[model samples]
Target: MNTLSPTTAAQAPPSRWALASLSLSMLLPSLDTSIANAGLPALAGTFEASFAQVQWIVLAYLLSITTLLVSAGRLGDLMGRRRLLLCGISLFTLASLLCGLAPSLGWLIAARALQGLGAAIMLALTLALVGETVPKARIGSAMGLLGSLSAIGTTLGPALGGVLLVASGWQAIFLVSVPLGLLNSWLAWRYLPADGPFAKGKPRGFDLPGSLVLALTLGAYALAMTQGHWVLLLLAAAGAGLFVWRQGRVAVPLVRLQLLGDRQLSAGLAMSLLVSTVIMSTLVVGPFYLARGLGLDALAVGLVLAAGPAVAALSGVPAGRLVDRWGTRRMTQAGLLGMALGGTLLALLPSASAVPGYLMPMLLLTASYALFQAANNTSIMAGIDPQQRGVVAGLLSLSRNLGLISGAACMGALFAFATAADVSIASAPALAQGLHASFAVATVLIILALLISHFALGKRGQSGTPD
Candidate 1:
């Protein structure tokens, strides 16, 4: 396989076919997140599983994919990005097929894990590909398109899953990816030129031992978050310690800790984590209020919730421009402020309210989020050297996933307390109390993120000029 592209204007611009390949590759993973989300009840009945079991089918995929993407991204650099992308597409397609055919919830969960692995490779390397294929001046546009697609995925996930669930049932949700995955694979093979295998010299091995340590740590962390296992959380700390030690000594560590030393990249990663926490938890909170508390139908709730992601996508181009001018510090600061406003709006929402009250704040939050998501990613990716693209991609993916994990766990605990009071979500005061506490926490997290960006990214961090 060929390695990095020679930095010359090639015979052709990356064709629409090439963009299609990358976009479709991106679309599948984005689809999987929400496609199954709205169909959970149908899936539970089909498999005869409980609510908790159904949740994991999605949660497991999130955790596994997040964990693997960083490693896979680095591997893409070491091996070949095109090769990794193709392999990921194939695996995702195969896993989607398996998910459709799953005999039990257990089987579906396992299948989803494989799908996550495939997504990790594709997501992590997507920008890396853009870095290689697109000219420097056009890279921002390419990344803008990427941000818009990601936002589109977020917006469409619920609606797409709802459609599949209504039309055919839960299995069809998984099956939806088959065509898209195949199309992506075919396009990549056709439009993407072959590249060299990574790192021709030294035979630098992947740090499997460190991977195991990280797996143990993050696995434990995810389990503790999902199951509320405090003991496992303790074990996770120990695992993290060992993983850090291992990475320092290993030549090509699974996670290069030195990358964290880049202040801007570090800030970008932190903000990604905190902001994802706030947004994802809001997703958790909003549906509960709509469905159980207000007694709205699932379809209506899904539609109402779609507003956030929709706003996010719409804001992408403008947000990218802001980042181009003001930099991530200002954009991320604004994003966090919007999040704080969103939480306040939700706190003031009346019981049995229409989508309007919730939507306005969500819209603001989404618009701000567009900048945070894209700008932070650009900051982190731009901070790293070309050689470390995969690794950085992996780290970015990891930070976001872990942040979501943290958010989910924290919110789960909060909700549990509120629910224990026998105050249904329909009780405006009760719901507000819970959301207020959680959102306050999220606000603080965002503030800390802003501080990190202010101090770590701008003048102090020598990653590079923002891409």
Candidate 2:
């Protein structure tokens, strides 16, 4: 367990192998998140479960990842990032194996939860590790590349999963990660820098009580969202209060409350939440419309959905350079505006010949995501000190996860309510109406995000401060 002192800086450029390993490690989690959706019907049929029950396969994974992210990040800081990354890759691989061999829906869901835990660890550390490894001058570009890989993984998941499902089975989707995870683990072991040793005289280790409380808070909130249970919401509130109190009292708290005082970082986190919410919402609603409303097959739906992230992936490197030159504020504003425009376009799409309409809006939305993610992440990470990178990175990841869960829940609820009469068997017209309503809601959210960015983010050439 080697550890570098907080004050120490990288003496040379990061190795390309190290960066490649990080990117490869990231792909598993990002791909898993979206890939399960494509195999939902197959999973349901195999397990003799209904659609609602099969949904747990996805929801369980999401809940586990979101709830554990902050804790994993803090632990990485206390323990060792390289160590955690290897462990995560190993655990994810094992979990993927379990998922592929699952005997029942319950077993699959449980395996997915385990997989999510591995993802949480990896997601929490990926950016922080990259920041530590890369030069300050090129942080934006590095983050941009990582963000692009993430976008590609997410976009490619469904398409790849569809092909796998048709060629092999639903189990193949989970099994796919086994070899990739092993390769990533080996690459990480060989390439990643070590954290020399735990700092001397630091509070004896991570704050277990605080971590527990925070996990409870996040878990309860996720359950409330997924189950629509008021009791879980109340528990979440209580857990949050206790967690906050514990943080103020504990030595080396899981998260330093003081970090939230930085306006730029805080705003960046908020914007990340909003942007992710819009992205996830669109991903969910768009597929439903394309598959059900338009009567397209899985392959067509996957292709249609891939366009947005594909555009984002293609433009990511350019967006990163622009952020370095033009600053985060300008790029973020432009991105948000693009998202608003995309959402508006989606809302106006007609029921017939919707593929063209969907493609154009998705392109705009994903491109916006590409631009916003790199710039916003760079701004947030730049504000924090090196010693606090892991926790701050966790917070950043937490914002995105929270946004994703909330977006899925909110949009899912809205769509369900809008089509309540035809909930079980919705007609094309009914599905179209629901999608239109959802897109309109997304448009409103983008506008709200724009206002938040304008008020909370700094102006052009002033990316360092909040307005």
lDDT of 2 by residue, 1-467 (tens): 11234544453234688888888877789999989999999888888899999999998898888888888888888787889888999999999999999999899999999999999999888888876676565667777888988888887888799899999998899999999999999988887777666657755468888988898899999889878898999999999999989889987788888888777778788888888888888777877778888888988986777777788888888888877777778887888888889888878788765678778777888888888888888877765676677788889999998898789788888987876655447888888888778888888887887887788764533552211
Against the true structure, candidate 1 reaches a TM-score of: 0.89
After superposing all C-alphas onto the true structure, candidate 2 shows an RMSD in angstroms of 3.6
The numbered model that scores best in lDDT is 2
**TM-scores for all predictions:** 0.89, 0.88
Among these predictions, the greatest TM-score belongs to 1
Among all windows of ten consecutive residues in candidate 2, which has the lowest summed lDDT? Answer: 458-467
**Model 1, residue pairs in steric clash:** 1-195, 1-196, 1-197, 2-195, 2-196, 3-196, 70-394
Superposed model 1: Cα runs more than 4 Å off: 1-16, 197-203, 289-300, 344-355, 415-420, 423-426, 460-467
lDDT of each: 0.74, 0.82
Residue 284 miss distance in model 2 (angstroms): 3.1
